[model samples]
Target: MNFEYSFEKISCKDVENFEKIRNVTLPYDYKQFLLLNNGGKPIKRRFQSKDGKITSSLMMYFPISESVEISLDEKYKIYSIGKIVPSNFLPIGIDPADSLICLSVSGNDIGKVYFCDMDYFEEDNELKKEFISLISNSFTEFTGSLYIPE
Candidate 1:
């Protein structure tokens, strides 16, 4: 739950502004994380499936700079447009391969983290639950799951 390289610290007000503009209620733990580190490179960057049969490495957590100033790629809104990312889900980070690391913002799955593989779809093009892999049941768990790859 630590980042060796992180953006400038942000206040709770900044997080509130972000949520208001984005129209989504962020998880409390995630909001606290934002206040600690807006975004950055994690110390432990890898995580794996339950059986360790599948593994993925994180690139960076997307900054909460939408309320400030940043590029489209750095902002979560760009990926959420046109429902490309799916409703009630937001891009919070990315894997090394540029796939999305998402967070659920509504329903019973609120605060849960998921992986959206960019190269999974063949046709249909619509994002579905089957295509999204549940990484953890909460943002705290997701951050806690990060580990150093062997």
Candidate 2:
């Protein structure tokens, strides 16, 4: 499977469009994050098959800063320096913050979306693939976000 992703900023105008999907998938906290960072440029990537049918997707977000010093502080780490939005959250009309958005568009159907610290790469990678497979095979939609508190 080819995993290609990007990030884009979410604008205030995009809120309702985002909410359309958010209502079905994301929780309140995720919505808050989107609203707070809509002003900045958020990364966005498109995932589709060779035939052009997008089966799955992923989004990553970055923070905004008025000054270099303020942006580079420790607080950046606490928030989604990497705003990772799941495929289930896609077709999202919101403009994301200005940051790097890593995305993947796959042929397999997506089930659940998980958000973990970047450090959990190995586990997230393995699980992401597995979740894709599960959704493809069963056509089941896994709801909710799995937050591993830092």
Candidate 3:
């Protein structure tokens, strides 16, 4: 089954340009998602951490748009002068508490999915595992794990 989302479309060129500017490669599952749907609300909104310590809904995926609000660049400001989002992480979506769901784009953890607990976001400029929990090894696993909470 495919993940169901609704949004305007962006071409592979858009993803390519963004990837080039960031000098990073998006995970196959996520890259495909961006190409196909751009981004919107997921059919199954709720998900839990692998350790089961966190459960939240996926409000939306950051679409590749010029709009300041929903653009991937706006949420992350990938190369902006003043940004607090962790290095090597892309803010993909958000949970109710405003915590970000991120994808690791580079280094050994590349392609990993994480639950970025914002309460711990300001404590360190660098991402710390204690606060950022590994939700899945890959974006595919991450989406597969999403479920609608009763």
Candidate 4:
């Protein structure tokens, strides 16, 4: 697959700092990927939705730095997932539809990736209202799921 957008490689120190600030351990596979490429857009971004009929596409991979900014941005207060996202649900990417591709850094679902639908929060839906769905068991699994579109 090709990448249309990407950030510079990050150092282990950057990852360490991020973990310390977020107070969560970064998933091994994701950490390695950050070291290789801080962030980038995936070429073949389509993935089957939970319903099986619809497909989703990732727009851009948010860099670790950008993720931090987004989390702290006051403009996104309404979109905050609060505890629903788990304190460690670090956003790694975004979908054109405003959904977030997040990594569960802490909790029973640690290391798992999820599609966090921002629209749910915008509508003030209940936390348990199925606003989030599992994307992959791990970062590696998620990457493996990606493919070049024919």
Alpha-carbon TM-score of each model against the true structure: 0.86, 0.24, 0.87, 0.80
Worst 10 residues of 1 by lDDT: 66-75
Q: Tens digits of per-residue lDDT for model 2 on 6-93?
A: 2244554455553353343334443445555532322233322223232333342332233432221122232222233343323222
lDDT of 4 by residue, 40-68 (tens): 78777876544554357877776756544
| For model 3, the run of ten residues with the poorest summed lDDT | 77-86
36-83: candidate 1 lDDT, tens digit per residue:
877788989898755454579888887866453442234465667546
**Separate clash counts for every candidate:** 0, 25, 0, 0
After TM-score superposition, what is the CA distance of residue 86 in candidate 1 from its true location, in Å?
A: 1.2
**What TM-score would candidate 1 get against the native?**
0.86
Decoy 3 TM-score against native: 0.87
Measured by TM-score, the strongest candidate is: 3
lDDT against the true structure, each candidate: 0.76, 0.29, 0.79, 0.69
After superposing candidate 1, which stretches have Cα over 4 Å from the reference?
A: 50-53, 66-74, 121-124
Best by the lDDT measure: 3
> Once model 2 is optimally superposed onto the true structure by TM-score, how far is the C-alpha of residue 116 displaced, in angstroms?
11
Itemize residue pairs with steric clashes in candidate 4: none
Q: Report the candidate with higher lDDT, 3 versus 4.
A: 3
